[model samples]
Target chain A: MSETPTLESLQAALDAQQAIFEMHQSMNMEVFYWWCTAIMFLIHAGFLAYEMGASRSKNALAAGIKNILALVVIIPTFYLFGWWIYNAFPGGFIPAEASAALPWSQSMGPDAKDLGTGVFWAAFALFGATTGSILSGAVIERIRVSAFLILTIVLGSGVWILGGAWGWHPDGWLLTKLGYHDVGASGVVHAIAGFFTLGVLLNLGARKGKFIDGVAQTISPHSLPMTLIGLMLIIVGFFGFLGGCIIFNGGDTGWTTIYGNPTNLSAFAFNTLMGFSGGIIGCYVATRDPFWTMSGGLVGIISVAAGLDLYDPGLAFIIATCMGVAAVYFAKLLENLGIDDAVGAVAVHGFTGVVAVILVGVFAAGTPNVNGLPPISFMGQLTSAGVMIALGFLPGYGLSLLLKKLNMLRVPEKCEELGIDEVEILAKPYPEAGVPAIAASDVPNKLANTELQGA
Target chain B: MGTSITTWENVSAYFTFADNPMALGLFVAGATVIVVGLIRSIIKHENEAFKQHK
Candidate 1:
């Protein structure tokens, strides 16, 4: 009467459905990582454009080239050794299976068996590049490109990665021993970069004409619109950066943090948006300047980043608002101290990063360490923060001082007077704008000028 | 096998090694590299001074 399915047929149907489900889950995680890696590229684009705009028209190209070269150098270097450093240094001494990340490793190339490592490495490389970019803007119009590349390699590939291995990695000594937790690298990437740049700034000195007779001068950007647009691009890129922070677990569990702590994109989205808006409001209240206003959005996010996984959304907003205001003022304080931070990288990244690290202790104390070494504590984060600052600042300061002694740190004063673009690049970003259309000898005098105006 | 939710405690428990000599060696090696890089940069600069901008 009916063509009923036999036990064998039913079993086969069930197996087929299970296989399809498994395949879909794996594919989704792969695509997710790829998407995050793609988004992180925006941070670099934003840095390039923003620094170019902040620089004088004469130095725009120099600023831009630095960014491009840093990206190029850091990428290859990261592949060769930086990846190994991350995998190996969790114990703060030796890398575990560090050879596995070497260029000769089979997994280093396309392998059907391993789908996640490449994309994960891509995302981390972007993070490394970002640390270099943060330093790029602060030192623009003055730093030697060669020195920048060397420092970028050191910081991006060596120092920052070491910090990550010690703290950010799942098996890091900080997490295992001190119960340290930083889900968003507020301390690992931002603070280290920010403070390291501070060290460089101390050695590199101020931009020429930035301070005169013990008073600070505002060296304005050539194009305000360009800077604004660049910042917006950075925000777009940040979506990718934060996405990379997550570890995608296949099947129903969905996502977790790099430390294997349970979390969701929904929580991240809520906190990120709230913090952004709160920062904007805080910045707008203090300084109506569009630059700081937009920057508040970034500060807000950093302020909330340390506790992004666990904070109430409203708390995220409040913390972001306070930090947004605080960041602007902190930049002012550094300016008062005669530091020439071209784009407030230190305040935005360093100060906010430190605050975020400490705030986690205050706000998120007793939160279970995702790796379960010890509970989150104020002392633990404080210790971790101090160690990170020392780790970052010492090498940066030491190396920059050595470069300074060698006279290879900053462009000569003459170059600053003429601009790096004119001296180094021998090209113009806006040749037409910089040079006049008519020849000096062909000038028609006032009568011709009147006629031209009439026409 | 299904994925496992790894808490901080669970992760810490999993990596049960009491000591890591490699990590200590890395710290020393890293310090050495930074110092060497700085000195090397100085030497390189002395041998071939970069052209001043322009």
Candidate 2:
């Protein structure tokens, strides 16, 4: 009994197909972000090696421990508050309506209805942790592990995520009001972290011999090879990070940036490679130093990161080269001002991010954000840059200042001279390097190692 | 709507968040991080402080 095809029947069948298509799209996005999270962990591993290699043999283990601890500590804190901040404060506070983002929300878990939130939340948590990694390198050797851990919590779970809520989120005021277009989080993550580290350094003081009688001296890395390898791993992680910055879907729909502007991984890959090379060239030309040269790759990517979804590969290279050169000179400028940023994080991440944010306006001006509410402009990015700097600097300065006054910020003076690994960790990084472990008996008020062992 | 956590019938049998035991479990983990970090700072600082009179 063949019945004439009715409009209702055709519509019903079409609706079923659309439902299947949408489900696949959601599943694909979830899977993509899951991998993105795994790849992003490489950034932390790279940071561990990079900072450890940068440290003198005495403090290498301490640097490794602090970096690892920051990674470990940030996870639970991010779960409790960082995710909530990202979802709730995107509308500039009051939470108006974000119960679904609450840690306690039924929707926050693996609900059959929503496949995206868990994976998306995991990716965002990794992004938040990267900000802590950026701060970790700069404060190595000199910072108290607990103090570093707390500051990592504050920055990773609190300050930087708030900036992300304002700039990175879709409904963020910066996006709605100013058309802020940081598709790669140049401002929210890198600049904020760099500025925050700067504020902390001003309070933490120079590592004892970093400055001598008003002159800055170079403290050589223990192993340049490890640092160079670690830098490449961070670049690889950033590729995954950039992949997460855009949305993917099934069917013929074009990949789009977080702001819904059409882009693809091809655009990201091209610009990342171009920018990475450009930074290396510029840094080698400027400093002729391997560490800065490797770091120039980071500077390059950050310099162009603001507009990765938009720039021509050639333009990205040129801009990255300029910023790479600028980062080295900027690091020197800060050094002159008595700020001792160990890995030039202040210049590499902070300075490059701010300039890249502003430069995107210069290059991509008049480009409309999603729905064309407002066009990108230099003023908009410049304004957002100011806010990011303040968000990073204020909490960093005030909280670290409190830590300093509490005598909990820097390592005890004697501890700094003896390597931190030997002083507190009790394990020598190099068994044959002849650095003796400091016994607790050396301190007048401290319990002796033998006494504790006897007990 | 599903509230029985021990039931194996469906995944939704567990309700998590806020006041739920699992949610509180997460909260306790976060609290431990904060407390342990503070304790470590204080102990390390006191253990190695230069003697006030010396």
Candidate 3:
């Protein structure tokens, strides 16, 4: 026979349970971020493959190395300053209260008192590295490795992090005052990188013999299949990149957007997939070329990214489809204007990113924001798009111009004529193909003098 | 005097950590790591969130 419990004893038991629950919640949070960082690496792998395949055989190895270096070099630099910018500037240029985010802070490293900080930094570092990779692809085959690394450091670790702080953070001015809502970072990540690449291209100029009599010439990929496969891998990596955008508040809070708006996983599932299909269809209908079709899938997702949290599935699909078509037109427009973006980075990322923000503003206007004082509106989104453009383009153009003036931006004309790999890398990409190493090999060995023969 | 809230349905089975101080510390440490991991996941994703059915 047992006696009835008193109220005080019940309270004691409940408190203990609450403590255990908090502990469990915190631990779950750490592990989730760790995996998010790990999966983000796949994005770099895909970019490496994609860029290398897009390049002439001689430049492939160098492209891969540049991507790898970006992945490795960003970790420390981001730790030193990039993560701090995210923590510091949510209020604007003036630093906010973020002692915990300081590089020397115990919480910034492995510390028993805090669990979330290190993983957060690592994941953010990956995000920063991604911005570098975007700029990396556009300038490949012509850029000096040293100059490229410096630009990568500035963009990946310096510039993009500022955009993130101002636009992506919870306490960001873009959100609190302007009612800016970019749940999927269409403006911050994609647009900023795209514009930055545009700036670099202005300085870097078109690849040699790419234009004759003010008309563009086609430069075919050595392995179209490899480029397409790499694009598919990038699509797979996007699943993880998208996963890192929301907060996993477990108990009373459930989940919320980075801006602290109501959301659920269902919205992501419907939109991301539908958007991909719509983009592919739109691209295929617009251009019969397989390469542009794959790019359309990426364009579609970005087009809908700004409103991913609230869009009806059908609307997302339709918006993505339109953007997919627009991406091709945008690319052609840039080409006509004499801008040589190697992978259509400007149209697919920069132009579509600007359009995506505007689309969401029109479609998602009057949508409630956190605290409801500000609501999503066209003007606010347009302003944010402008900011993203300036943030990306100004720094990109200025730094690249400086590099050019110093003669540190492009490789020597002779080296470029022979292939970057032959000047920089030592391995032969297609050793047995016998297709003439002078055009594509990494080394000036036996293959350099050899020529193709009848099959 | 207060009676225990140890109802038949509510009482949890004890883990060894509750009895050993060192083990309890380890439990908290492990929990910290896990929570940190989850926070990293939640914040980085352009996520699809699941609202637990209350």
Candidate 4:
């Protein structure tokens, strides 16, 4: 203090302060990621409500409970091993030398030292839950709760996580080798979920009375209001789900571009609203049905989700619109094939997700990689999308077939006819209606004299 | 012990005292409503069961 501080020393001190400031900024971003991940958990609630509403009254409670329970199983299992798989499998089948992010790993828990792991793990878990929800809708009324619960565990915790590890991770082999770029998991999440549902459907077969002599019958939802409410919630939750991925980058020189430039919330807001509007209009025009119209909203967002970060609002809207229309027709096509997807999960999630992956290539053709490599190309995007569909569908179908052979995939025909609620649950949701009341006089007469009862 | 309580306080403070408190509050309110809905559902179930028994 006595000597006037040298310019070099002052500069050094300023540099140190700047580094500390950057550290704090990074920590703030980590906090934001955690909050966003938590918000994404609402999507599960939305799915639960949506699927329950979509299911017949006989299977409503079962559908709701199954979707919720998938999370309970997925979270712990994923925590234990799922995180490791994501880091390990990015090279397709090969295991990488990356540090295994196991549940018991020191980095997993609340660590002031490393802030990224917790939020990232949570984000992946939300994706897993979404995958499970997609399967829950397809096999609602006919499937046993126990069997479906097991399926949820396998798909939510195991199969989907592995796929994410292989393809979704930036360092994943699919991305590194094939130049794959599914920015928001169109293929990794939705396509995989859809195919998995298809696999289960092949084994589970159609719900009783859904097919009569090789012809499909329509079973409409009991409550449209509930379904609409559920869809709205899903839309709201998706903002958090998709936005979380973008906001979580560790070093922000203040809202950097996907490739580290500079961005803002305004861009996301513009794209999301436009995409949603386009999807709604597209579905309405294509299907002329209110149900498909609502479903179009999901398709629209998912279709554009893979490239939303780079896309202009117009592009986002157009992609979303096209995706919505495609999802409706694809769903109809599946139904025509005598595949009874109770909630059209396969068509909406799988088909739209695959399309979105391809669209990303076209739309984000020249967008620079965050790692400063070449921009993602159309051919590269298609190849990656194809790989995901093949990987997801083949194993999923094979596993379902194996489960069917073991008599574990679907309930018996007798059980399906009696209703899964009556046979498996041992507790009817609507006990009064399910158990018809016998008059006291009639009951006594039946016991005393069979002939009197007949008369 | 002091540190733990302080950490909790810090977390809580981040939530309520953030910019765009209305949006944050609405999100929290939505969560609370879902929770309350679940509780109401359980209570209704119990009431229905009791009625059936009666």
| Global lDDT scores for all candidate models | 0.82, 0.85, 0.80, 0.72
lDDT of 1: 0.82
Candidate 4 lDDT (Cα, 0 to 1): 0.72
Tens-place lDDT digits, model 2, residues A47-72: 98899999998889989988887887
Q: Which 10 consecutive residues of model 3 chain A have the lowest summed lDDT?
A: A104-113
Q: What is the lDDT of residue A40 in candidate 3?
A: 83
Q: Which residue segments of model 3 deviate by more than 4 Å?
A: A1-4, A435-455, B1-54
Candidate 2: segments with Cα more than 4 A from true spot: A1-18, A249-253, A434-455, B1-54
RMSD of each: 10.5, 4.6, 12.6, 10.8
Error of 3 at A96 (Å): 2.4
Q: Compared with the true structure, what per-residue lDDT tens digits does model 4 show for residues A50-161?
A: 8878877766776777777677767766766677887777766777865637443445555555556777788788878788888888888766555666677678777777
TM-score of each: 0.84, 0.89, 0.84, 0.80
Per-residue lDDT of A361-438 in model 3, one digit per residue for the tens?
899989988776488998999999999999999999999999899877887776677677766565667776776755
For model 1, residues A28-134, the per-residue Cα lDDT tens digits are: 77898798878888888888888999998978998998898888778867877788999998998765777767654545655444667788788888889999998
TM-score, candidate 2, is: 0.89
Query: Is 1 or 3 the stronger prediction by DockQ?
Result: 1
- Most DockQ-accurate candidate: 2
Error of 1 at A16 (Å): 5.0
Question: After superposing candidate 1, which stretches have Cα over 4 Å from the reference?
Answer: A1-17, A436-455, B1-54
User: What is each candidate's fraction of native interface contacts (fnat)?
Assistant: 0.04, 0.05, 0.00, 0.00
DockQ of each: 0.05, 0.24, 0.02, 0.03
